[model samples]
Target: FAAVVGSVQDGGLPHAGCRCDNCQRAWADPAARAYVVSLALVDARGEQAAVYLIDATPDIKFQLEMVGEWLGPHPQRPQRINQPAAIFLTHAHMGHVAGLSQLSFESMAVQNLPVYGSVKLVGMLQETELWRPLVSQLDLLPIADEQTIVLAEGLSITPIGVPHRDEWGTGTYGFKIDGPAKSLFYMPDIDSLAQWAAAETVLNSVDVALVDAAFYDAGELRGRAAVRHASIHDTLAFWEKIDSQLVLTHFNHTNPLLNPAAPERAAVQAAGATLAETGMVFALD
Candidate 1:
């Protein structure tokens, strides 16, 4: 099963230094707050469950707590929660990689934890002096594009390269997780569907696709420079003919779909797409 630990975009619901209406609601109510986008894949077929985290978001601490049961207790320190078996990074974005700092000497202090990312992404981490110490504490593995890594008997993950903003020249990846009886595709960040030539084919091939829904429309940008994330309106239109379950996620603070009462939420539902919520679980079998 795959557990959604967080559903909001990088900065999360109550974005820093922003007093937007949505941020205001989240600030006023704890229940309304959300963390950055992340997913926990759990395989409990054996005596000991295998848990893998996709994207180590800035909200990793709380996100780990959400999956504490599956992680179980720490092996060395019984009082603390066990670290995930591995972490698969999607890109070099702040929300996707910031949580690594928490796992360093100052905090979790995880040892030899396998962290997978693109060759360039891993290189960037290994070359940075600030992260050198943390890098030594981890088993950094560079993954090739479209390479399938088998985690267990029937659980495997393939990191498919996707078009997105890559300032550091490190590519973005959308993970395709194949479980015993089902497959899921997770791409929390993408520049645009039109830019990806294989977008339709790949999305339709999966049982469920948790895609980027960062904004409702261009208008939400408020005349700012164009962003890389795809808008909800464009995503819905692109997946109109697809049969796979289109689960929208990675919402920005300004996105109207975040509001339960917003008509855009109903519109999305009417279009046969559902919104991604934290703690939502998807069965693999």
Candidate 2:
């Protein structure tokens, strides 16, 4: 099963120092807090299931705990850390790679685990003085665009290049994960639907597509320039005819869809696209 571990955008719900309505409500209620977006794929066909994390979000500690059953107990060390089989990073964004520090000697001290990312991403992680020691424990495998990596006999992942906010020109990827029984397309941070020529074809090919839904409308931006992410309304319109199950995720704190009663949420559901939530699972065929 591929689980949706966390669903809020980079900063997560109740974003730091913001007093927006949603943020304020989240601050007042523990139930309202949402972690940064991340996904986990668990292969439970064997005695010990192998777990792979899609992104090492800032909330990775809690996200790991959420999948403790699959991770099981540490084999040789004390039971303080439950490690995933590997970590695949899509980019170098703070929210996406922040939790990498947790694996350092100061924290979990995971040993010799596989960490996959672009060439530049792996180089940056290894060359950065602050992360050098911790990353030394990781086997950084640089993945090329469109290259397929086999996880198991019937499961594989391919990195699909996509356009996004590339600060250092390090490419961004939207993974195409093919499982035994079904396929999944994860495009958590694309700039816009118009930018990708293969968007429709790719969405039509997958069983489920968890896409970028960082904003609900342009109003959320106030007078500031709109960033790279696409609004939910835009996604709904463009993906309305796709055969795959369109699941919206990576929500910014200001997005109205976070409110259960909000019309935005209703609109998405009525249009047949599901909203991603923590712990939501999709069985791979």
Candidate 3:
């Protein structure tokens, strides 16, 4: 069945042109990590469907409601959070999976929600208190660097290794999802573009590649986060060498590229990719 999945990236620099308190307390000291996010993967046809969320941003309530709205008016839809089918965890970052707590008894009480991540990922969640209690409640399925897991019929997801500073889980993963009609790659938070040079075959093979466009220009980040992932993830300069239909995401609050009419857009368009928008939708067939 064809699916419509969206990664809703909301909010911006908390203080606008300056870093917020949250960033000040954090390790990298980003301007702010206050983005209200949640992604929904909808299988509209099967009636029996699934929703795979890439990163569960802090805006949990709103995001979950949005996902339900995206499901549209399905008369026979299951009235349970289990209807979401599954969730593909990208990392253990505070903003990525922090919203899982919302699925507790006070909220949806989502039991047995399949969460796919690296084995190290599972341990990380187990080691942490917030995520540990719910591990048994929600079915947390751990996969390795190269493990391929089937989400649904005709839709298989394979995680590729990528470099990153791992605080909670293994580094990061670049997913290769194959559907019946087309294939897709989601590298939301990668380190640098060079990391894919050796695996160019896989990175360039997809019809649409959702990449990591965290920084618009070099030296934007306050410290390590900025200069760190340049070689493994896609930078504006990184795109110069990449040959694919790229849609960049996991943007830093500092990325001037988020502006639709900004010069960064022009440069991104010229680089053969587009910046990912909150509601933007794309198809492969």
Candidate 4:
């Protein structure tokens, strides 16, 4: 399935190494924007084949190489497939596709890595000077919402829209994956679940959901009480409405999760939700 944490700046990347507490006051230090690359998806045959990466995180080279190794066997032992199935993306943030350039000739020398995204996002990539150049050389494909992308007999992906900063594209989205064994809903970033109309249908249908946990408690960070990011993501107070098994991820430095023993931590556990840990893996199938 999808690979998490691929970035050069481990803290700046979403899925790699975000800790807790970089309050607004801390931003003056230029180190509070902690993040990690988040990529996810499974393949055909209900396996992690045709792995779809949600973002082309900064650590794309090493991450893809790892995916390739897992999908197939190593060169010495070789499995079944030749390459990763595909890649999907949310907004064109630097953490999302910074690895695209590395996939080009100057970097790892990988080939057309069918990257799927919304229409405007595709155009953004095309119109941009850097990623646009990759399209001319690499095989980047475009996709739309509700478009059923068939990876193979048992694996298919349908993009569902979510609201976010759209300067680079229109509405961003979470993904609904259909495989032989089970389904998963992954929305790494969204302003608020209330912003989505079909949020109920999307969350209820999946066996597991990896939702935004960029913030653990509101107003925990100094001077961030009025900031939107401080209030947007699913708060510990709002977990009761969701009916699926939840795994909170996409953490920020200000998040209380950096401390496993915090009251917020106790709150998440009492609610039956799990936290996303680095190097965590699961086989839905």
Best by TM-score: 1
How do the candidates rank by lDDT, highest first? Answer: 1, 2, 4, 3
lDDT of 1 at 161: 94
The sequence of per-residue lDDT tens digits that candidate 4 reaches over residues 48-160 is 44566777777666566556645564334343234455678876666676767776767655566677888887777788775665787555567788888877766778888
* Per-model CA lDDT versus the true structure: 0.92, 0.89, 0.61, 0.64
Q: Score candidate 2 by lDDT.
A: 0.89
Residue-wise C-alpha lDDT for candidate 1, range 1-285, written one tens digit per residue: 998999999999899998898999999998889999999999988887878999999999999988888889998899999999999999999999999999999999999999999999999999999899999889999999999999999889999999998899999999999999999999999989889988988998999999999988887867534577887778888887677999999999888888889898898899899789998999998
User: Which lDDT tens digits does candidate 3 get at residues 3-107?
Assistant: 323332323334234543333432254322334433455555465545567666666655556567544443453664343677777777666777787877776
The collision pairs in model 3 are 191-229, 191-232, 191-233, 192-231, 192-232, 192-233, 193-232, 193-233
TM-scores, one per candidate:
0.98, 0.97, 0.79, 0.79
Model 4 error, position 267 (Å)? 2.8
Residue 159's C-alpha lDDT in candidate 3? 82
Cα lDDT tens digits, model 2, 1-285, are: 799999998999989999998999999998999999999999989898999999899998899999988898887875655689999999989899999988878888888989999988888888889887887889899999989999998999998888888997778889999999899999889888878888888889999999999988887867525477876778888986688999999999999989988987897799898999998999997
**Candidate 1 vs. true structure, TM-score:** 0.98
For model 1 the local lDDT of residue 133 reads: 91
Output the number of the lDDT-best candidate. Answer: 1
What's model 2's TM-score? 0.97
